[model samples]
Target: MQGHGYGQPVKQPPHTAWLVLLRVLFVAIGLFSIGFLAWAMMLRLAAVTRRSLDWGLFIAVLAADILSIALLSMEPGDEIRTTSGNFAMFLLLGTLVATIAYYLAADIRHFMQREQAYAAQRTAQAAYAYRGPASPHTPPPMPHTPVPRTPPATPPPQRPAPTHIEQVRAELDELSDYLRKHDGRHDSHESGR
Candidate 1:
């Protein structure tokens, strides 16, 4: 009646306190549902890499939602309506919010687990590079055994001597050295002239 227009029917506005209380209750229930789902999933995930599709909080939420709807359907002025399901729609909305949050949490968990597995595999591959390839110049790791300093009875097999490329490189190097020496001499003679 406070906000009623001259020709308009009286409209009842919900009390500020009741509205605030109902909103808070809805948010609290929704948050509780989400948190419960996340905690249960995390525990289950710890048991195995495969996620559990079954949610423990799901039954609780469904029960609460059903209870709220039943209470809301009661006639106004009935003791049931006043005592229970007073904020039926709000509680129902809360359940929806909780469900949405639960699914998001599951998706995030799956994505994060996949990323962790990929990173671990990549790290295992990189570990080979971290130690790096053995160089021919460096000696191989010696065995832990401590042998006497006696020389070998027979010499080890000799490696084949440097071949064609080595011969060509040596020849080219000698020719280059000769040309450099002559060029210096020619330069000095020209300077003198």
Candidate 2:
């Protein structure tokens, strides 16, 4: 018996402490920062909505990015002489690496899980459902009551066609009437204002 039997405590692989730490970091920093960054952008664009906490995270991330860029731009000959500067550089770089790694792993895992779910659904459907080609048989018969033939459509009663000049005059009259009504109202409204 190489494997543990039923009801017996199975010998599972030991949990990796680093994996747990990575998950915590991923949720705490990766998700939190990304969400806040997006929210802050929306708030900035809208101009009316403001949440200070989200904006704080956005600013912090932006500062970190700027600092990292500066650190990377420095030549190998140049170095941070201060202890705090060195620590900040190391912390920024390490966090960037960890965030990238966690995001990539999480994304790949999500994709794989979705793919597996879709595959399983397809397999289950294929196994249980019979989806052969549609029957070659003719369509079903209509009701026993014979369908009545439709009568030919009659043309609508036609009005006497007006001349082009008359049409234009009619339109002009409508426009003049509209202007007459609105112009007085506009004058009264402006006077009131």
Candidate 3:
């Protein structure tokens, strides 16, 4: 009666196969993107007579693609026969969107960090400027000193002392007497019934 009617623990559907397929697809797409980007870089470099292919960006994109693919591929079940296929598709699509969003977010974060650093640098420069040279300079004439004022004294307020053990015991006894009287009345009424 404590167990389920099925007599066995329900098994979670396998999704491993679907994850593998999604990962493969993601990697394929990523490789394609990299190739395209490289080609684009080459064209740009050729046109300007300078290396414009940002290796850093290429590496970053590749790393992101790899990590995304890995995460998607680790999911469990056969993509062709199970619900995993649909899940794989959804995850792939989501990964693509997330990748783009992450890229934009990363760019924005980088820009903000750079801007903050620049502002901090400028602030430091301003502070240093205000400090001026360390060499000794002519000091200004001393101003007249004002007399110090004395503070008014006030008497301290008195506080009651803490209750001693005897006082506490007396209070506890009073409470006990009150409770016993109430209990006695309750018992007498119950017995009469």
TM-score of each: 0.33, 0.30, 0.28
lDDT of 2: 0.48
Per residue, candidate 3 scores C-alpha lDDT tens digits across 55-146 of: 44445444544554565466564344445544544554554554544443443343444444555445434443443322223322333333
Candidate topping lDDT: 1
Candidate 2 ranges with C-alpha deviation above 4 Å: 1-63, 67-77, 131-193
What are the Cα lDDT values of the candidates? Answer: 0.50, 0.48, 0.44
- Descending-TM-score candidate ranking: 1, 2, 3
What is the Å distance of residue 58 in model 2 from its true position?
A: 9.5
Roughly what TM-score does model 3 have, to 2 decimal places?
Answer: 0.28
Q: Is candidate 1 or candidate 2 better by TM-score?
A: 1
- Model 1 stretches with alpha carbons more than 4 Å out: 1-54, 73-83, 125-132, 135-193
List of clashing residue pairs for candidate 3 = 14-76, 14-77, 15-75, 15-76, 15-77, 16-76, 16-77, 17-77, 19-73
Model 1, residue 77: distance off in Å is 13
